[model samples]
Target: MKTERAISDEFMNALVDDQLDSDEKDYALREANQNTEFRERVCELRALKEMVQHAYPQVADAPPRTRGRTSLRLSHLQSLAACFMLLMIGGTSGWLAHDISSPASDNQMVHSLRALQQNDFGIHPSKYVVHVDTANPIRLKTALDEAENLLTTAQDTSQPSQVEIIANGPGLDLLRTGISPFAQRIALMQKKYPGLDFMACGQTIRKLKEQGIVVELLPHTQVTPSALEQIITRRLKQNWAYIKV
Candidate 1:
């Protein structure tokens, strides 16, 4: 919280990393405007951030893979994505990691603040990991509605990249080939949200197969070993909003 005139290199790094508070950010920008030297430093930091992001272009736009497929390798890509996110958030000390037996989310107030901020800028994506555990048409519709509402309400200037929808238990039916009433809707939403993930739980698929229930999923559905586990490690750890339906 040093005065803008005394802003240190640490402060400059935080600003470049998007970690400054609103008031401090304003102060730093004002300083940069008045001081040619500081402005040049700011520009250099911005260039560095952009360079790092561009270096990992493949990680961000890599093709979506099924979460449940045993042979499909996505852990490296997922980890790389998380690493890039940590760079943006400016830390490795806190937050959850993507893993089956990992812990829960942290700091509800922080989560709420982040959720509120997602509406303001696309600079740091407002992430979400929605749980669809029931095939009840009402519940499914609500989850879809909320997710669509998020995309619809995002700042007109930003393109989002961290939203995910995971289906497990009876909810896996929503992505099933023939029976889901939501199949068409899912397809349409996927088309609308390029980074949005529509996932199916592998455990559920296996159970259904054992029961002799025809278990074909939609063509683009990503399969993961366990939906809840996937959410905990991949989505929740990174501080994405978790919506359970």
Candidate 2:
């Protein structure tokens, strides 16, 4: 059995080296396809051959130069040549080690590195800000959906836009978890686009809580009643483009 295994190993090597006849090579390749170990060994040999070729300096098909001794010292020339060869071998070994270890992770790292270097800054300017103000639960939800669609279009065109849904007065009730039909949608949109700011009136939150309504709404960064008024005032004062959805 040991002799038979040796003969099989020799046959596989011959097939890989292309020393076998075409029919025999085809049979060996087919057998390798079904044998993971054989396929891996073949790949390993190929990689080793490539590594050796890359590590060693290639000799030119020319006769050695016969020249007189140079002014440069022989020891210095030898040291420089030795350093160059060491550098070549070290570089090749490092590259091969990196290639064979964590290949998938290396590819992912390269992709992430490329993405980090790509800049998508200043590609668009803010065109408009949509303000949704309504008390009716159904209408408020419809308006929010429409506003989201407009924002999507702006993003698709690489155009910037802002949305400020000011739930003030009776409309402020929309920010109450169960009060607004669009509360879930609002939460989803906030997560999807971190840049899109959702503001609820602070006074309204206090009012709702006072009325014994449980309010698990958006974060405090998005809660500003005074800022809502200021936003509206600025849009009106500066005549900034606005749409009420």
Candidate 3:
């Protein structure tokens, strides 16, 4: 029952920077996925990190500027930070900080998904990628529920659709043979829907193997080299609707 406040800024910064070890990283991802406040905290921190990087480029890459340039840049960054903090503290509703502090193009994928119409299931033949990054049982079941619902709805409407349940990090447990609770259900679903796909992150499997653990996936589940790459490059870029469950 660790609350969002219980997680310090340092820990969150580590999580954003990918500096945490496997257990810590998994815990952070699970919290961000399951907890609203924590998710916002992570998002805001990530945005700020990006802003900082943009404002202060590497010494090698950045050219020198005017004498007052550093202060001017700091002032601009401070304004952004102040606006972001004010929105959070004032309870402006539904990630308003993201809207005010960053441009639409700079917003994260989740932000884009949020603005997407629920009825608009991306381009036809509708395609969806359900992303799962935690091993939490409730979330695992929820992922199955989402994928099934999408497929079922498409079938009922006689619309051609594709759904892929992609798992990474601890979420890979959902596709692991003998480890997943819903193995039978997944097999049945695959039999029922030819457009449905299940994928495991090969990066996760490799890391597990490096730690001396044998990795095995349920039958019919394919492995992608990296879950992030697959989700961003192959799915999102291809106009597939994304569902994080």
Q: In terms of lDDT, which candidate is strongest? A: 3
TM-scores for the candidates:
0.49, 0.41, 0.56
From the highest lDDT down, the ranking of the candidates is: 3, 1, 2
Each model's lDDT:
0.64, 0.50, 0.70
Which candidate leads in TM-score?
A: 3
Worst 10 residues of 1 by lDDT: 94-103
Worst 10 residues of 2 by lDDT: 93-102
Whole-structure CA lDDT of model 1 = 0.64
Model 2, residue 196: distance off in Å is 1.7
Question: Tens digits of per-residue lDDT for model 1 on 196-233?
Answer: 78889887788788789889898798999866457655
Model 1 alpha-carbon drift over 4 Å, by segment: 1-125, 155-161
- What is the overall TM-score of model 1 with all chains considered together? 0.49
The pairs that clash in candidate 2 are: none
What are the RMSD figures for all models against the true structure?
A: 18.1, 29.3, 10.6
Q: What is the lDDT of candidate 3?
A: 0.70
lDDT per residue as tens, model 2, 12-124: 56644556766675566576668877766665554454345434423212343655532333332233223322222332332212222324433443333223224334222
